[model samples]
Target: MVHFMSFLIAFSLIAVSGKASSGFLYPQFYDHSCPRAQAMVKSVVAKAVAKETRMAASLLRLLFHDCFVKGCDASLLLDSSGTITSEKRSNPNRNSARGFEVLDGIKSALEKECPQTVSCADILALAARDSTVLTGGPSWEVPLGRRDSRSASLSGSNNNIPPPNSTFQTLLTKFKLQGLDVVDLVALSGSHTIGDSRCTSFRQRLYNQSGNGQPDNTLDQSYAAQLRPRCPRSGGDQNLFVLDFVSPTKFDNAYYKNILASKGLLNSDQVLLTKNKASMELVNLYFFGGQLSTWPTT
Candidate 1:
């Protein structure tokens, strides 16, 4: 769980105005500066996702991690040099966060078309939006003209991104700090429907969850048994498991349904139902189509 005070600081940073004269994001920031920016980003992302569907989820998660740390300023993309320490080495990102190659490709194409016209920050935002749409999710006009950060924050990355083992209250607190509510939490978590989680992310739930040499009781026994063979107590930390077993490659509400059945892959996910009434209601809303009345609104 992230500290409450840190959350406050994060929100404060996000509230700061950008360097643009208007200090706000708009959909057409690059209309004159670079006309084909959006098309190039979408084309690259589409090709990458078409080659590997999971890349869609990876790109979306990368954007989320970036925004949470430094208000989506592209700090996560910076490589370590002189005074800069890359956030890529942070705990939450080390071996888990990916999709950098796709971003590099987009940046290269944009630079060739119009040098330094497209900021990496806007590229990330566009890539995230395109990834969602490519994966059968919603499409939206991503505001552009975000400036890139000259510095990166490894500590911020480690502290801000919620861990898989976080408590439900802690996860909600993190979301609230970002001006997101239970609805956003449930909605955004649906991204897990398409991604994969490493064994290290959920090993505790498979063995010695409470230091009692027993699997987590909240996890379905059959699922736990199914997970242990590949996710052994000792090794196989890098093995991957689909986050949403029911629809592993789709961006839908099946993730909510999995939580309802105690089949959630991560403790942070299962706690949505066990820890709070509001979250449970939200989960049910998505599960039964009450909240999903307007579908594909990711």
Candidate 2:
């Protein structure tokens, strides 16, 4: 009962409508299966990532938020003003306004192509996977057909997401709760290869530790020295960025390999390799031994 081509027709009209102004097309004219409709979705998402880092970050964040909490419920995609609550966060919600704009872009394109036939939830899932590949993570085909959520909850922060300091056990529990197996956890963590966290988020591992062969200590001694100027005492403007200078913006298994070499960027990342058998096993397979080349195959 989904007409796909109409969605493309709608987007083509928007493209032709000129850059000065564009709005939703007639709902009656929307379709679902059109290749153009899918193309519009891809095109709009790409434009968002190109113009706004926050937009891209938020999309990836939403995917992690959803999968870690409620099995990819797409709950994080809802706007707070839209008659719903959202999950909680240790820090204030860093919801990016640009993220909403990108969502709108997708919604508008879909509306022109298929009216309201496609759900916002589906768009959210697709956007997350699309965002991941854009940021140099593995590409996996996600099945579509998700429905829009009517409400958002601030309480989702409680048990859904893992904090930067979460222990190995806690991280495993969090991911397992989301229906992801150990392999998925290791595979997904590769996301850290891009982006950044605040310096204060992981300074304790550097200044407070008794010399352990930790990557934070080996952080290009020069890089660590430069960070001190910005993070002074691990507070105020200590936010660390997660960009993997070696391969920024290319989806690959390099992140896993970094862990084996003790180049993990965060304490949580390092802990996965050092603590617990299940985690160590996966880390060894992917990071230590380079088994991720055909990961998810087993």
Candidate 3:
């Protein structure tokens, strides 16, 4: 019995040590690595760019689009074959056919390049970065090797994503559920700097601001004017414009600065500045021409 106990104790120590060194154990997405991780990520991202360019002009609009009224649900990824395995209900914002076409092309290329060595989840992450930069956002280093989710849950998609009108707490909860920190949440929301939100999406934020939840009164006059035509009183396009006016096709920190100066379009975007103290600081950092600051780099 004494000998058996000693062996058990030794085995437990090894197991704990292994777990500790692996790191990013929770939320699961962070726990990934590919055979040629960085190279694979780069190659696939380049493919997403090519695919986007090949599609119709309207298709590019769909690819970089976000689900503000519905939250950034990636359900737009599910096809008829994918829907059955998706873990969440499909969001209408995901109806962009071209986005998935690009994704499929990337997947096919990766298969030939590495043969089941990469995960679609990782491809999505890198492709999104490519898409954002292509649309005029800052290109940060993308962490590679995310695992493919075995199943899709439409229910999870609806409950997990944040609404255009979600409160600070709700937004934090969504990020946490996805294994992102509050800082990451603030930064990720910056993606909105280049995209547009439909009038219907921001109508409540504009007219009955309170019911819509987040209310910011500092946007420029002309900005509202440009949006008004599309987002009328009765409800029209809710697609609000992003702050990266110079080049909506490139990813950068311009959106962060916009928030610092009260130029964020979405109520949720402005709320990051007004609602959270730390979030505001981050916005200021970027707004004032600060350096890029998210991990996994991109």
Candidate 4:
């Protein structure tokens, strides 16, 4: 990294201590331990995203999959071993969650800069933040100093990460379990603005949404028609569709607008508008005032 890319992150979490503390994460944990750590991560992520714009969303997804199970300990990054079963094989992550090689590149750089000083958990967090900003999203200071899990939990991964077909209640319940509220759910769902979903992930919405041989009425008929060609009833499970049809590669509030227009690609997404009022208001808040980035940090 000949030229360091500096991003001043004024967002910092309170430091905690003691074994009983709720959190021990700190945004500036690596300031002295590895001064170049964040910059190194940004450099790699910028290059990776440059080669493939979608890589930004993929990297961000890795963080979500990891944190949903075991609280961002990087257990999702582990490989199956003598006594450990990798979370990669979990239903939510199997053949999905990607960007491990990008993390490996980041960890390798951090190790070279300060051997044993950086943790995989921190790397995942930083990489996710960098990926978001690279895709024209807001940049936030991520908490660091977390450790990687010794063992991966396949069952936890499957049960934790909300599926694309989850109802509004299921999605909110999952977020509540994580100490997040409805606003968090709607705001986080906005991340779909930059990602792609496999045909299988949302094929149910295209057809047979309620097992009556009808497509999800919540989805715009035209969008469903566009999806049906590539994603048939039983095949082409791997076909990719931009989650947000309006601005697929940009990280913004278009996802909320899609939900409003009934063009939401996934069942879980449309539910934000149809199933709940608070979330719907948040969606409108973002779509109408999306340019302000008014998402509250609760």
Overall lDDT per candidate, in order of appearance? 0.80, 0.55, 0.50, 0.78
Q: Per-residue lDDT tens digits of candidate 1, residues 65-108? A: 88878677889899999999999999999988899999999999
Stretches > 4 Å off in candidate 3: 1-89, 96-98, 132-145, 209-221, 238-240, 289-298
Model 1 stretches astray by more than 4 angstroms? 1-22, 291-298
Instruction: Report the C-alpha lDDT of model 2 over 1-298, residue by residue, as the tens digit.
Output: 0112122222222221111112323322224454455456667888888876545556766656654444445555665564555553324245221265687788888788777676565566667667765654434444554555555556666555777767777777776665555555555665666566767566755564435535355344555565566666536554555545456555445655666666666667877677756666666665444333443321
lDDT of 3 by residue, 50-104 (tens): 6553222223233223222122233335544633644223453443224565657
Tens digits of per-residue lDDT, candidate 4, 92-142, equal 888888889998999998899999999887887888888888887776667
Better of 3 and 4 by TM-score: 4
Superposed Cα deviation of residue 113, candidate 1 (Å): 0.9
TM-score of each prediction = 0.89, 0.73, 0.65, 0.89
In model 4, what is the error at residue 34, expressed in angstroms? 1.1
All candidates in order of lDDT, best leading:
1, 4, 2, 3
List where candidate 4 sits over 4 angstroms from the true fold.
1-23, 290-298
Candidate scoring better on TM-score of 2 and 3: 2
Which residue pairs overlap in candidate 1's backbone? none
Instruction: Give Cα distance to truth, residue 270, candidate 2, Å.
Output: 0.8
